[model samples]
Target chain A: MGTNPVPNKKLAIFTATGCRACENAILDIHYQVSSLARCADIAFWPYMLGSEVRDLEKQESIDVCFFAGAIRTSSDREAALKLREKSRIMVACGACAAFGGMPGLVNISQWSVVSGQSQRTMDNKQQTNEEEKPELPPLESRVLGLPQIVKVDYLVPGCPPTQNFLWAAIQSLVCNGQSPARLSFAASRLPEAIAQAITSGILPPKGSIFAGEKAVCASCSRVKEEKRFETYKRPYQAYEELGRCLLEQGLVCQGITTQEGCGGLCTAMGQPCRGCFGKAEAIFDPGAKMVSAISSTFDSNDAQEIAALVDDIVDLVGTFYRYTLPTQCALFSTPSKD
Target chain B: MSDFEPKIIAFLCTWCAYVAADTAGIARYKQKPNVRVIRVLCSGMVDPNYVLKAFASGADAVLVGGCHPGDCHYISGNIKAMRRAPLLRKLLEEMGVENGRFRLEWIAASDAPQYAEIINQMSEEVRSLGPFSPSTIK
Candidate 1:
C-alpha cells in the first residue's frame, strides 16, 4: 500500500448547456491552475479536454466532480445522474447548478406551452422548410438544480463562481485534509489578510451556508430610513438615486430576503439584487420571504391599495423567484394527469 | 359540479377567530361543515409556508382569520397579517391558483355570525372553482 504513495485526487468538471463562464472560471485561477493541476489529476472535463461521458464512467471513482448548469433536458439529467454517482464529493458549481438560475423562470408555464410558443414564433419569422430546421431535444417538464436530482456535497454560488472561491475550496480539500463545511465568497470580500484570518478558524456544522447569516441589507451600504412606498418602480422605469435603499426608493431590491455573499456588488452599483444566491438560513422560499418584506413596507393595510402596489411588479414569478423557482419548497412541478 | 364539496383549511387566530368559532358552535349558527380549523396564537404567527403547505397537501382552499385590525390582542398582529395576505394572494395568482381559493377575513371574538358567513361563502366559491390541481401548487 505504501509503495504507490501520494495518491492524486481525481477531479471531473461537468457542464450542461451552461454559459462558457464556468469553463473560464477554471482557467481564471491564474498560476493556481498549475498547482491545482499538480495536486489533482483532471480525470474528465468535457468542455476543455473533449472527454467523453464514457471516459468518466470508466474511472474507478472521482475524488471531486464540479457540476455546472440546470438540468433542462433528458440528456442533462442523465449526465447529472452519472456524474453524481461517479464522484465522491459533488460540488454544484455556479448559480445554475446551485439554484436553478435564470432558466428556472420557465417554471411559470408548462414546458409544452413554452416550446410551442417559441416554435410558432420561429415558424412565422423564418418560414423555413422542415429539413432546414435543426432538431432540438424535448425539454424536461421543469428545470432542476443539481441537488434536486442527487446529493450535492458543496455549492459554489455565483453566476459563474468567482475563481477565488473555487480555488479556496479546491485548496482546502487538497491540502487541509477536509472541505470547509460551507464555502462561500463572503469572506473573500474582506481584505485578503482578514479573509484568511476568518477562514482559518474552526468551521461551522456540515450543511451550513458558507455565506453571511444575515440578509444582504446588513452588508449593503445604502442608507435605510422609513421603508414606506406608495408605488414600485421597475429598474428600467426610473433612474436610481444614490445613497438610498433601493426598496425605500420604490425599487424591489430583494436584498432584504436574499443571503449576503455577493459582497453587495449589484446593490453597490445601484442595481437591485436578483437573489441569485438563494434564501438565507431558516428561509424556505426566498420569493415568499421577499413578498412578506415588500408587502410589509406598503403604506396601507387596505387590500385594494396593497393589490395596487403589488400590480406595479411586472412578472411576479420572474420578480420573486427569478433564480430559485426550481429548488423552492412551495414550487414543484409534476406531470399533468391529462 | 354541483356535488363537489370544497375542503377548506382555516387558520384561525386563537385570540379571536378560534374563539369566534367556539361561539358559533355555542350559539348553534349554521356554518359549512367542510372547514377544518387550526388555531394559532396570533394571525402574525401564520407563516406563509403554512398556507402554501395546506394548499399543496390537497386542501381545496385556505382561509386565514385574524382579529379586526385595531382589536388585535398583540396590538398590531392583525395589521401584520393584513399586510401579508395580499402578497400571499399575488404569489398564489402567479402560480395559477384561481381566485377565491385563498381568503383572509377579520373576525372579532363576538362575530360568530360573520365567521359562519365567511366559511359558508368560501365553501360555496371553492365548490364552483373545483378541486385544487396539484400541478398549480408551484
Candidate 2:
C-alpha cells in the first residue's frame, strides 16, 4: 500500500486557574482528539513560556489555538494574540474569552471609577504639591476581555462551553479530512440517548439539532398561569420554593434567558440563572440582558410604568448579578430621557 | 467571655506565613484559639473569592499574611496579592462589611511577634463588631 500522509498539526491550550469551564474544555479535548492527541500540546497559565505570553507579537507555527480564560487585563490580550499568531485556527474557549464574561460587566464602572480617582489625584497634586512630575498624568486602565480587544476567530459561548464543543473543534482540526459531525439539542437539555452516544465515542451526525426550552419559568409545568405576578414581593425569597417557576410563581427569572446548559441549574434549584452565557444574540447594545428582559415584562409604551416595574427587580439584579454587572449596565438602569 | 471568641481565617504563604506562624508556635507564643490558618504556596495563589467564601461561610474576619513586597519567595506573587487584597477590601466595604474585617499584613519569616500581633488585633476588631448574622452577609 502507498504511504499514508500523517497530519502535520500542533495544538496548545491556555487556561486560568479555578476556571471550571477551562477544566471541562481540557477534558473534552482529551476524549475527542484522542486519536491524534500527540500533535497538540497544552499549556496552563504562568507555565507559559516568556514573562508574558502577550508580549510575544508573532507566535511560531502551529495549527490550532484555544484560550480558556477571561482576557480582562492587557496581559491576557497579549497572551491571546501570541496564541492566535501561533495557530492556523483560533477560538476563545469560555464565557470570559468569548465576550468578557463577568469581568466585562465591570468595565464601564471600573473605568469611570479609575478615571475619577486619577482625575481627583491629579487635581490634588496640581493644587497641593507643585513638584515637577510627568508631562501628562498617567491614564488609568482596567481589564477588558477578548472581542473587546482583538478580532476573535470563533467563540464557544458558555460560562464554560460544553466539552463536546471543545473536543469537536479540536478533533476537526487534527482529523483534517475526517471532520466529526456535531449534534444539536432542540432545548438546552441533552437527550439521554444522545448523551450516551456522545459518551460512547459514537460520532454524532453533522447538522443534528436538539430542541427543548423547558427550564425557564415560562416553561415550568407547575405554574397556574393566573398566579404569575408582574413583580417580585421580596426578590431574594423568590428563589426558595421548588416545584414552581420563579417568574410564573411570582418571582423574577434573574435573567434566565441569557444562560444555557446545566438544564437551568438555578431554576431547578428554585433560583434564577443570571445570564452567564455571555450575551444573547439580539441584545448587543450594553445592558441588553436587563433592558430586553424589562421591555418584555412591561408595557413598552409607558416608560414611567416600566421603570417602576424594573425597580422591583433592581435589587434582584444587583444581588444575583453583582460581579457580572459592568457599571455601564448600572447607569443604564432607567429608561433614557433622550 | 470565651463565647466572644472571633472566628478568624488566615491565609499564609507557604514560604513566609507558614514559617512565621510555626516560629511563633515554637517560641511558645500564646495565640487566640479562634484563628484558623490555611497554608498556600504563594500569596498569589490565593483567589479573592477564597477570602469572600470564607466570610460567606462564617468567618468573622479574614487575614492574608505574606512576605514583604520584594521578599516574596516567588518574586512578584506577593506584589500581585497586594494588588488583589486592597481591591477585595474595597469590595467588602461596598458590601457593607466592616473595612477592618479583611487585612493584608506583610510579615517576614522571622517576624513571629508581628504575626501574633495581627491575630490579636483582628480578633479584637471582630469581637467588637459582635457576631456576623446571616442578614449581615450580602
Candidate 3:
C-alpha cells in the first residue's frame, strides 16, 4: 500500500498563534525530517515567512501537511482543507492538533462560560426564563486549536508529544508510508535506562503492571498495601499524602486520570497521579490503576468490597476526567472533522 | 425588613424531584408559597448558570432537587447533577452569596415528605439570608 516516493515532497508545518508547545513540536518535527530536507520543503505559519506562501499560487505545492494547533477559525478550516487538497499526507503535527490537546478542554468548559452569560441575562430578567443564550463570539475569538475544527489524518497526543513519538510518526510516513496515532510517548523508551544503570543490564522491558495491562505505574508498589480502611471526616487538604499511591494513600488520583502522557509526572514527584489520561484503558485509569497497584501491594481483600472501592474511586475521579476533558483535553472535544 | 416576600426558584428533575414536588402538592404538603418550581427532564439538564441566573433576576435563593444517585431515570443524570452541585455551591460562595442561599437536594419520586422538608428548610434559610439586592448582581 506504499505510494510512489514523493521526489519533491512539500511539507508545510501549519501552526496557530500563542502556543509555545506548537513551537517546540515544530522544532522536534524539523529535526526528525532533516534527513528529508533535500527532497522535502517545510514551512511554518505565523512566525515563519508563511505569508508569502499563504495562498496556493506562490510556492512549491505541499505533499505532507503538519497541523500544530486546534483549528478554531473558518480560516483555519480552510487552511486545513487547502493543505489536504495540496498534500498527499496530512499529519496532526502535535498534541494540540491531534486530540485538540489542551484546546478541547476549552470547548467543554465553554458551556460554563455560556452559562455564565446566561446568568447575566437571567439577572437582566427580560421577562422570559426561556430566553435564548447570547450568541457565541465568532470562532476566531475563541482559542480553538486544530482538531477542534478539522479532520486529522494522524494524532500524537501530549502537552507536547515526546521527540521520539513525533519522530516516529514522521519516519513512519516518510520511510514506511504509514501514519500512526499521535502517541504520547513511545513505549520503547522507558524505565529501561534506569533499569540498565541499576541492574547492569536493561530492565526486563516489563515495568510495573496495571490491571493486567503492561503500562508502567510509578506508584505501583505502594498500592499493594495489605490493609485498607476509610475515614470520612478528613479535610480536603488532608487528601494530600506524600509518597503513597493516591488510592493506597486514600486520596483521589485527579492528576493521572485526567492528564495524558508522561510517566505520571505528579506521581514521580511524590504526588498521586490524578486521572489526566482521561478514560484510558485500565492501565491508566487512576481507579483501575489503583486496583492493580494496590491489589499487588496488599493481599487478601474481599472481591465485592474491592469492586465497590473501585466504583467509589471512579465516582470521585470521574468528575476530574469530565472537568479536564471538555475544558482542556483535545481528544474529547475536538470535532472529528477538525 | 421591607414587606416584600422573597422570591425562590426551584429547578426540579421531571422523573424524581418533579414528581416528588407534585406528590407534595397532592398530599397537601403546604410549604412556602413563595417558591416557583420549574420541572426539567433531568436535574443534569438544569445548567448551573440557570440557577445563578435565577439569583441575578431577583430570586433570593435557588434550589435544585434531583433523584438520588444511581436512581436517575436517565442513568447517571443525577451523578452529573451531584458533581455540578458542589462546584456551583462553591462558585456562589465565592461570589459572596451565603452558602445556604443555593441548595441541591436529592429527593425520590415517592419522597413527598422529604420534598416538603427541603422546601421548608431552604425557604427558612433564604428568609434568614434577607431580601435580594441588585448590588449582588454581576
Q: What value does the lDDT take at residue B94 in candidate 2?
A: 47
- What tens digits encode model 1's per-residue C-alpha lDDT throughout A1-338? 35435577889898875786877897898997886776688999988899988777689988888888888888888888899788877888887887777787787787778778767866765565666765455677778887788877777777766666667666654433323443234245433433464477532233333455678888899999986888888787656578999988888898887777677888898898888777776676676777777777888867788778777776767877777777763745332111
* lDDT at position A265, candidate 1: 82
Model 3 lDDT at residue A133: 45
lDDT of each residue in A42-74, candidate 3, tens digit only: 653545644533656565566567666665555
> Whose TM-score is greatest here?
1
Model 3: lDDT of residue A178? 19
Compute DockQ for each candidate against the true complex.
0.52, 0.01, 0.02
lDDT of each model, Cα atoms only?
0.77, 0.55, 0.53
Error of 1 at A285 (Å): 2.0
Per-residue C-alpha lDDT of model 2 across residues A158-219, encoded as one tens digit per residue: 56665554454455444443332432221113534434445455533332222122323334
For model 2, the docking class works out as: incorrect
Candidate 2 error regions (>4 Å): A1-8, A16-21, A28-39, A43-59, A110-112, A115-142, A173-227, A230-236, A239-243, A254-265, A284-312, A315-338, B1-138
Residue A299 shift from truth in candidate 1, angstroms = 1.5
Off by over 4 Å in 3: A1-8, A29-56, A59-61, A70-85, A98-139, A178-243, A246-256, A259-261, A271-338, B1-103, B106-111, B116-138
The positional error of residue B60 in candidate 2, measured at the CA in angstroms, is: 47
Specify the CAPRI tier of model 3: incorrect
Of the two candidates 2 and 3, the one with more favorable DockQ, higher being better, is 3
Candidate with the greatest DockQ versus the true structure: 1
